[model samples]
Target chain A: MNDPKSSLTQVRDRIDSIDRQIQELISERANWAREVARVKGEGLSAIDYYRPEREAHVLRMVVDRNHGPLSDTEMVRLFREIMSSCLAQEDPLKVGYLGPEGTFSEQAVRKHFGHAAYGLPLGSIEEVFQEVAAGHADFGVVPVENSGQGMIQITLDLFLTSEARICGEVELRVHQCLLSQRESLEGIKRVYGHAQSLQQCKTWLRVNLPSAECIAVSSNAEGARLARHTDDAAAIAGAAAGKVYGLKTVADAIEDRADNTTRFLVIGRSLFPPSGNDRTSLLITVNDKPGALYDVLSPFAKRNVSMNRIESRPAHTGKWQYAFFIDVSGHIDDESLQAALKDMGPVAEQVRVLGSYPVALP
Target chain B: MNDPKSSLTQVRDRIDSIDRQIQELISERANWAREVARVKGEGLSAIDYYRPEREAHVLRMVVDRNHGPLSDTEMVRLFREIMSSCLAQEDPLKVGYLGPEGTFSEQAVRKHFGHAAYGLPLGSIEEVFQEVAAGHADFGVVPVENSGQGMIQITLDLFLTSEARICGEVELRVHQCLLSQRESLEGIKRVYGHAQSLQQCKTWLRVNLPSAECIAVSSNAEGARLARHTDDAAAIAGAAAGKVYGLKTVADAIEDRADNTTRFLVIGRSLFPPSGNDRTSLLITVNDKPGALYDVLSPFAKRNVSMNRIESRPAHTGKWQYAFFIDVSGHIDDESLQAALKDMGPVAEQVRVLGSYPVALP
Candidate 1:
């Protein structure tokens, strides 16, 4: 028993030594990132100093090299935060997102850019695009889709008119919580939440707080704000909203669906170079005729290029006319995609390559 | 000029005469609807009394028969409301939706089922499904997609597990407004809105109320509720929300995107027979192999089924595995789709027919 205890102490000592080395290496990496930023700043603008594609490449490499008990996702996340902190040493990236703060959009910005980036919570998706286009923000993150809901039309419409390009994507798993000042659900008379949040948590609330009046608020954070002041009111919101409003979780993971995910796009002034594994978004208007859609898709199909998503929207120029937004694997620079684009020209009335950027890290 | 004025009066008299005939015909139609319900009640349950497929067929016919200054869309809407009222005279449908009222979901319910259907505002999408499946509500209306955002995962996820069928669909053009008790934007220290509404109206708010604090609440109606009580606060919401809360519109049509729209699904106990113009939604899981996605898509393409949308979601049964939700133009009962499904059997690991229903009227 004494020998075992002594060996455990030795193991602890070794771990302590390793942690110190790791900490020092992280500091060293930050210094190197600062140096790289300085060098880039000397030759380029502040916006150009941070290369999202390069960062994506580095993170991909981290995943490739990782073979551990910890997941590749965890490893990539750790490296991203380190890189973000390091990059902040020179100048923090200014990121705009749709927010009054404590919304899922804010969460997506943090997941993509990390905590080191300064988040500018704008009022709308258009503002996010405008800020990025005007260079008021280094980049903007706005939600393009939810796994449950089909699409956000405003974002797609903005892309049609704005010069902003897709630079990266972040998929956030939306989790709702029951928050309140009260310790239990028993005393809760009213529940406040964003309409969506309330919808997300409805089943749970029905099963638990059967009689509570579910009040729809502007945001989950706003619900939390209201819940904080009331003794009998609870709020349905994200855990972050709970934290923001200083509310405690009366119940956790109250959302009806376990895998409710929102997909957000990082919009920048220009498309970045491919990060080995990338996706290209295109806006296509097909000639109004039978098999027009089939003709538009055949080029990619014949080339064996995989399509990720395709959505049709009213072209707005004419009644019954539509514009299709397509997401396909590979960058525009790739040979197969280039060939596909060339072939698409004859069938499509207009084909605009929105941008090529790295796929969101899983 | 005297003759023209006299002729105008004569035209007005003719218009009044026509209006009287139209009103009597509408009443006659309502009586016939009630009579049809009585006949249906003899052999059918209350749930079967409302046939969405039949209603869709009638609406399509209305569009086909129209040759007037009123657009097909306008004509269809008017007929829909009439049908809704007629249906209500027999038995009002208890339609469940994500609501505390004044949410877009509520609007969709009204647009599809009309004011005649008793809107059973539920807490969540799951509850909506549960209500429909359990026969507590005659049908449930839930948002399946947005044009701006991609999919609502929870709704799709519910479809995977619930036995509810898609009987109809509603597409609503979302419009936001600034409502306040105050006369104008001046003296508004705070603006309250649902996060999405705030985001939708962000550009207008920023340009109009630069110094006002934008506060996110649960729903736009909730925001209106707050705004109604305060002189210095304004709410960004839909016109319905403003009406519900007794607030005047400070600014109208303030959404950044003119074409902001949401797609909602009408869920019921079982699939209704096909309308002439219909859409089929399928859930397919493919084998884990290269070109698997292509194999799944090829079947649809070869038959020229014309897929409307395709979305991939985590299968949840395993990590990195995906299940696809596909919308194709045509009913499953159609020969082409039937043949396509047969061919898909070999390519897909599992295939579930979610539902086949009428395409939403333009």
Candidate 2:
């Protein structure tokens, strides 16, 4: 018989060699990123060196070229992190998001900007915009909408006044977990989570921890923090929060919805150039007329620009007057969108192009 | 000036007399509601007596006829509550909602069904549907979408299998507050809230309670429960939650967004007739083709049936295939929508009319 031990050893050696090669390629990529930084000059700020459009383009290519046992999303995520790590070698990008650490916003920052980027957790979405506009942070990631909810009005309202521009978007599938120090559900005396989290997991909690005193806390991280300290207490939070607070997951994916996604926008000081596939957001005020909305919409529809979302808010300029926040496919630079804008100028009271950036990866 | 005290007393007496007259009218309305129950027969279930479409029509009329100091929205709300109270005199509508009590879902139930309706706080959205379907409850209130988020996938998915139909909608303006026993931010060493609530009030907390340890809990009411017990702890929750737990609001309306609204759907056993101004939700599956989405959308666009929202989800039947959830203006019974559906029949694999109900009161 053939030597089975020798064959197994040979396979193990091949695996080790592949890992080493992969590590070497990553190192080379980091060197290339540094070289690019050097070519850009040392005087330039980290924000200038970080090109969201360029990164988006590269990520798109990675997805397009991918065909493997690994899913496209997983492959893209890996590349993004690798790119983030390499970018950090030159100068870490400072990204701001609403947080006290371990919030979903923090997770979104990590997801988009990568682990190597410096995440500055701000107190509010307004502060996130302020920080980005003031150049305190390279970019700010604020939630724009939730799949289960409609829109984040505060973020939309900020865009009406703030000079911040949308550079990218991150869609995070929010998963809630039951974190506890106890090994089983029976030992839990109280359950802690954010109010929303509690509602999200109401069914699971009721089925499992029916009689437990469910408490509301500031954040999932906070719940995890409390759970860490108390043996009988359990928390409902994201797995990331549990990891941060060193708690064990008694149960996972406890959210009521299977696809609980929150869409976040990366806000920057200036609009980035298009990355082939992109989305344009506009803030428009229409003239008070019956067909004003139809007029605004017809331009896009005629031009074959697919409208992604439309939201109406109090114009704040006049009582009962409304401003429409519109998201449409195609970058502002696209000829079709340009033609649509040209057509819209006469019908709309005012049209403000918020930003044009790459769409979130599917 | 000569007899100011006498005038004040006379005004007080006049106010009391008006209050008595109002009470008599309210009593008379309640009696009529009982008569409605009696005419409908005692054998009918509570759900049978509760007509969401009828209530919607009445509320719309209330808004249209109002020409007073009170806003149209305020007027509609008062009439709704009064109607709800009257409906309860016949037989309290058993409304199920995703809850442990003091949650937003429960709030939605009360907002739509009113205080007199027996609010059955269920564990999950599925339970809500199940209860309503099994005839255990008159109607079930469950969150379908948030103005900030997209759609609740689980709810949509349930529509595919559940027999429950959308009866009405309730739009609740979500407001968060700081509740405490110590009465001030200085004494608060720990803050409790849901993860989302914590993030919502992140800026406020950072500015006000920078040093306070924010903890995550299951529900805001739970946090209030905790806050009620601890002198040094505070909770970020709805004002209702505070009332439920006997905690005083240290600060109110501290949410990051001013117009944060949650849209909940009232689901029942069968579809009700249209309320004139109505919305129809549809679940559609399109065949595998390049222009499948375009084909699905063209019918609505061509028919001038305004499409409100469209959401795509995994079909679950095939890998990478999708199913769409669409919300459109007008009822399924309306000619425009009916024609649109007829046109869509040839293009779509399947079309399911989930429900047609009144547009939510503004």
Candidate 3:
């Protein structure tokens, strides 16, 4: 019986059978999710199906229980996509991110919600926040900070005005590639990249394409797109973004910094229940006096709540006063955080709890 | 006194006079800086002339003493440029940043060192460190984090390997603009931008120039370069960067978020003395256990060191373990911080101080 077919064909047939089984199981899962949605929404005019804490718990389980050839992160990604499809069957989680099809913001959305969720790539972080706030999208993804670049002031400033709450956070490592339609670097008249990527790959492009004009594009994907149309142009973008246009990689990982990572926030209407490993963000305005910052932070010190991050932003338009964005370990529901928040009132002019959400696991 | 003089010309004349006075004062200051360098270098063949603490004090004084039409930040910028010139006169403070002249990293270098110093735009953050380590440059500037984007991982990762210390930090607000040599957006068939800028201006571009093929470039200045040559092309970049190439602003402040601030670090061979308002950074690898991070951070909490930021990065390849980058308030010289550092060693597998530098005053 084994002699009738080659190993390659037999393996291919096995893979097809496995895919069919996987699809069947996913369909069953979707059916259950839909049934649960119907049961939960019976008497309600509006339904809230997405649960952050539950999803976090499930993802943690996926990582914890994973015993495979695939890495835990890789496993988590696959499971999340499956969950995304299941959630979509109940009610598709409409998400917004900065988009023109192939930017990193879109990647963040896909990473967090999976491919089954709808991705609406808006023009700006503000638009993203607005769509979520206006209830057009269930949640919006926005870049909060870059490990290399620090806090995105615009996103922080938007937090001051927008009521959208931080629902979750995710990080993506940025690996830039130089992609073009041309087979070789010869006859290349120009190299296009994102400003950050261009800045990241400044040395490489300069040394390699000395005579070619280097241009800054909006996104690496956009660079790939431009490279696709222009005969003499090459683009610097991520492998995933570059792959979309079928552009060939002329140079891979052209970024100057080897570990360029970006942190993104998922913003929605309300904060979810806490995940065990969590972070609480607070925006506080300090008093106009010396040692103002010290006074604001002493409460957390007293409570021994491990602070994750503290960044100062210029308060209103052209003013000298500052507001501090503080990230501290522990959910807001935790006892230490409750005590700390109580004492924080007097020291700060204003204190707003951004949210308490699960910390990103790798 | 004012014959051919309009109000604008008279003001410009007054500015010229003030500028001449400034030049004289700056020349005198440069002489003093050189004298200090000579005095400090007297006995030693190898000399460390940069004083982060002293510069911080001076900047603080500039902010404190200003009673002005110009804001404190604006005043510090002017003084920093002047002081940069003075420092250059002493050692020519050769500084490196990821640049092709017009990116924000170059702005950061100019902001910290002033225009008088030689600006070397290297290819990457690693190259910046290499130049500084090799003594080709006195110091290198790298972006640590952005308000929106979070921490730049490459810079953080470099700290794990580099001996470079954080000497100082500065923040610059990102204000992206649409620039062109073209008369109007009407005939604009192509819009060029950097990735970050493109992402920042996504909504605006989509709404304003929907049909235009948005291209990604290496730097906004590079985009300005392309727009200068191409008839139908417009570039999105910083105003100052665009101005260098004489590109006209078709639309200013096109960024989605208003407070897109980027934080940059001045990295060098040594750490700075206490500047009163200081922040100390550390690289730590935690032991494998539950709440391992908590164990490492408890010491800082106990000492009331006021933790600033904490971020986790995967420790080596194919490993589930992580290494953390931490920032805390107070200099290493401070009593509490010194105590905290002493206690941190036992709890962590490895602990390395990145630097103790003055907290940036926005």
Candidate 4:
């Protein structure tokens, strides 16, 4: 049998060797990043705007091996964030989201920015984008769609009208709670929540509280805070928001749909650094000719690129026409993506890049 | 082009033909099921035991060709119920579940049963199985695991001790709502809900209703009912339940986790009809020998089968030992399953089949 002391020493030595290797690798990477930052500061930009293609190529190489618990996709996500942070160190970004306190958008902001940038909260959605365009904030968070409620038209309209680049995306699960100020279930008559919250719990409200008048507020957290002040009122909000507002939850898990989820968008003035599994959003207006829309999109389909979202909005330029907002897989730098966009040019009257960013996964 | 009226007529005729074909297919399936039931009934007295192998083969055929918006795995679930209902027509099956009203278990029962059977709500989990054994209920529903709180030990303990067959399973999303009688935010003092509901919203309650006393009741619906009886007290429950009990929603969506989901089990005396993706639960007691547990599970891993849940309970023989409840994928009738169970005979002091049922997807 091996001696106990020897076995313990041997294990510790192996761990120390692994730690030394990891530390060396990390230090080397940091040095390279700093060098790149200095080069960019000297007006010698090292970034490859077309780097997503190169990133995808690198990941495919690792995935084809299938050697470990870390899947190719996972490694790519980690590396993408690492590289993004490193590059952004040359020019740090600031983001604005809808909040004074807890909100889903705040979470989205954190998710997109990571620890690389500062997140600021504004009073309204318009203020969020304004902060970005006015250079107060580098990015903005806005709700795009909810699983049960279809698209958020306000965000789509903003994209159409605002010049801020759509830089990134995030998805958050929506859980609502009934919060109250009262210690007892006595004489409570008022309910408050965002309009969307009231709609999601419509079926339940119709049968249970037929006589109570429902009121819509700006946010669930605010509603909860209001409920804290009013003995007869309760707020409908996410459990986290309720906690922040210090509202007592009377009921929970109240969304009409069991799998209720919400998707949010991040907007900035600049494009995101390449992430392998990236998606680009664009607003395009095709020619009036029949099949023109098909012609503009056919190049993507033929190349097997997938489109995630497609929506049409009125041109709003007194043209009596509509423009399509399309979100498609593959960043603008990919060869196929470039070709597809090039092919689309002839058919499109206007084509605007909303920006490309990393994909969010469950 | 042909006349518009004639084209419309032809399209309508084609739609009618498709509808007729659908009806024919449904009838043919029903007839085959009835024939299977008849054959089984005739053989019941001649054969004391059911042929699980044959049942499994039939289910495998159904699963193989499943093209689905709901995956092939999810398709097996509905087919399992249809087959179970057919099998039950030959001999009545008793089911039990925790009840009074407005519990998620009730929804699980309806979902698994498909509105064909009567669901009896028992006073307790023990009563649910007792009713099944006494021929009062054919199956029982009990919450097993919650996303936020982990396992419901009482339910686990019952599975560890009881001999009831777990014939099927289902998952349901739970939502909570705050209910009240008042129309305006005025004098409310107390809040009511199930203990777990109150716990989930503890953070929310502290901030919103710091002065309000949170009281735990038997069920969310019960809380609502109680709240309805009092003027200032509010109840926490499902939105539907709140409406049914005539309570106003003061707050909603109060769970800590936004993606909160619950998994429930359906227990009956009879074995369930096979579904391709089945999970068989077993409670095992070993002599506390080294490698004893490993030996029992190794066979499954060797056969490429995955185990989903592993729980331990006191052996209840007034000893310091424990029994393990394991849930593994694969129908018990499968060859790999048979081999694993057969090999387990010598290693286990006692190996009892808690049940083999279709895994429910939320």
Question: What is the TM-score of chain A, computed separately for every candidate?
Answer: 0.80, 0.81, 0.81, 0.66
As a whole number from 0 to 100, the lDDT of residue A333 in candidate 2 is 91
Clashes of each: 30, 33, 49, 57
| Model 1: residues with Cα > 4 Å off, grouped in runs | A1-16, A34-46, A64-74, A177-191, A201-212, A218-258, A318-320, B1-362
**Tens-digit per-residue lDDT, A104-212, candidate 2:** 7876887787655766666689978887887767789999887656698899999878888888899988788899887778789999988878887888888888899
- Kindly list the per-residue Cα lDDT of model 3 for residues A260-316, writing each as its tens digit: 789999898897788788889999887568988888899999999999899988888
The clash number for model 4 is: 57
Q: Tens digit of lDDT per residue, candidate 3, span B1-362?
A: 23433543443344333323333333444445555555455432112666778778777866766554334554565456545544544335567788545456876887777655666666688978887887767778999888666899898888777789888898888788888887678899888887887887888888999999989986565576578778889999777545444578888888766777889998988877787888888888875689889989999999988987999987772355669899998888899988987888788888888889998876
Give me the displacement of residue A138 in model 4, in angstroms.
48
DockQ of each: 0.01, 0.01, 0.01, 0.01
Model 2, A157: alpha-carbon shift in Å? 1.3
iRMS for model 2? 34.2
Candidate 2 lDDT over residue span B1-362, tens digit each: 13644543453344333333333344444554554555555455455567787778766766666543334554454455566655654446777788555467876776677655666656578978887887767788888876545578898888877778787888888788999987777778999998878877888899999999999986564576578778999999876556434578899988766666788998887788887989998888886789999999999999999999999887866665668989999988899999999999989888988889999987
- Stretches off by above 4 angstroms in model 2 are A1-9, A38-43, A177-191, A201-214, A218-257, B1-362
Select the stronger candidate by lDDT from 3 and 4: 3
Candidate 1 structure quality by residue, lDDT tens digits, B114-173: 655666656688978876776767788998887656688899998777787788889987
> After best superposition, candidate 3 residue B2: deviation in angstroms?
92
State which docking tier applies to candidate 4.
incorrect
Where is the poorest 10-residue window by lDDT in model 3 chain B? B15-24
Tens digit per residue, CA lDDT, model 1, A1-362: 13644554453344333333333344444444544544444543335567787778777766665544334554555556655665665446778887654456876886788655766766678978887887767889988987656688999999878878888899877788899998788899999988877877778888999999989987665687678789999998777556434578999887777777888899897877787899999999875689999999999999989999999987876655679999999999999999999998888888888889998887
Model 2, position A297, has a per-residue lDDT of 93
List candidate 3 stretches off by more than 4 Å.
A1-21, A42-47, A178-190, A203-213, A218-235, A239-254, A317-320, B1-362
